[model samples]
Target: MPPPALLYALAGIWISVIGLRSVLVEEHFFRKIVASNIFGSGVFLVLVALARRAPEGPPDPVPQGMVLTGIVVAVSATALMLALLGHLHDLEKPDNQEDPS
Candidate 1:
């Protein structure tokens, strides 16, 4: 059987591909945002898997640290994207206020 790290890497690759495809094909901005998150998660998974490649030695700390930092950035980016989307949605709505006489 293949090593666990190999399996994780393969899964991460598959997930990244799927997410990228969705991001490219989907028209909705919300879906694209979700897909982007998936892509980021897959990248992090792959990085972690790579860091664990040397089973006999201690895992690399750099990739793990990078992944942690990336997660923080991703969350912040997602929040900003969501806020922008909300603003765009509000802007697209027709005004319902009555005109002053």
Candidate 2:
């Protein structure tokens, strides 16, 4: 039987590949943003899997810390991307105006 970590690593790699493909192939900006988030999540999962190298001992703290930090960064980046997307959407809308008589 394969170890749990190996399974997680494989899943992460698969997810990352899928996300990357979507980011490259999708035409919409929103879809690209979502794909980027998925890619980040997959990377975090891989990091977590790597951290669990020693089953007998406690998992390494460094990778765990890095993952935590990365999560925060990812969230912030996603928020920023969403805000930018919203701004772009607003800009694309046809503005309605009342002409002064």
Candidate 3:
């Protein structure tokens, strides 16, 4: 395997290990967020690796397209979820926001 390909494979493996460890250990909300970040990033790495060896024939548009779509969706979902979590926390303790009643 080429050096770049090998490096990518090793990185992918390491990221997968981190993801697994994240699951087995303590799972606080922040930790879970970190894990999600790792996992989504790992998937992106895999897609990139596949793209590295992508064939010239017949075009590999599908894989590229899917990865691009996934990146957008994952980023949006993560941002929304994090925002919602923060909002929930704020709701739990409304120090700044005055209560209506």
Note the Cα lDDT for every prediction shown. 0.93, 0.91, 0.73
- Candidate 3 residue-wise lDDT, 1-101, digit = tens: 45575577568768967876785685576677778778777777777666666434453566678888988998897898799878987988878777689
* Candidate 1 vs candidate 3, lDDT winner: 1
lDDT of 1 at 46: 96
**TM-scores of the models, in the given order?**
0.89, 0.89, 0.69
lDDT of 2 by residue, 32-74 (tens): 9999999998999999998987766898899999999999999
CA shift of 2, model 2, Å: 1.6
Candidate with best lDDT: 1
Q: By TM-score, how accurate is candidate 3? A: 0.69
- Give the residue spans of candidate 3 off by over 4 A: 1-3, 54-59, 96-101
In model 1, residue pairs whose N, Cα or C atoms come closer than 3 Å (at least 3 residues apart or on different chains), thus clashing, are: none
Worst 10 residues of 3 by lDDT: 52-61
Instruction: Output the better candidate (1/2) by lDDT.
Output: 1
Worst ten-residue run, lDDT, model 2? 90-99
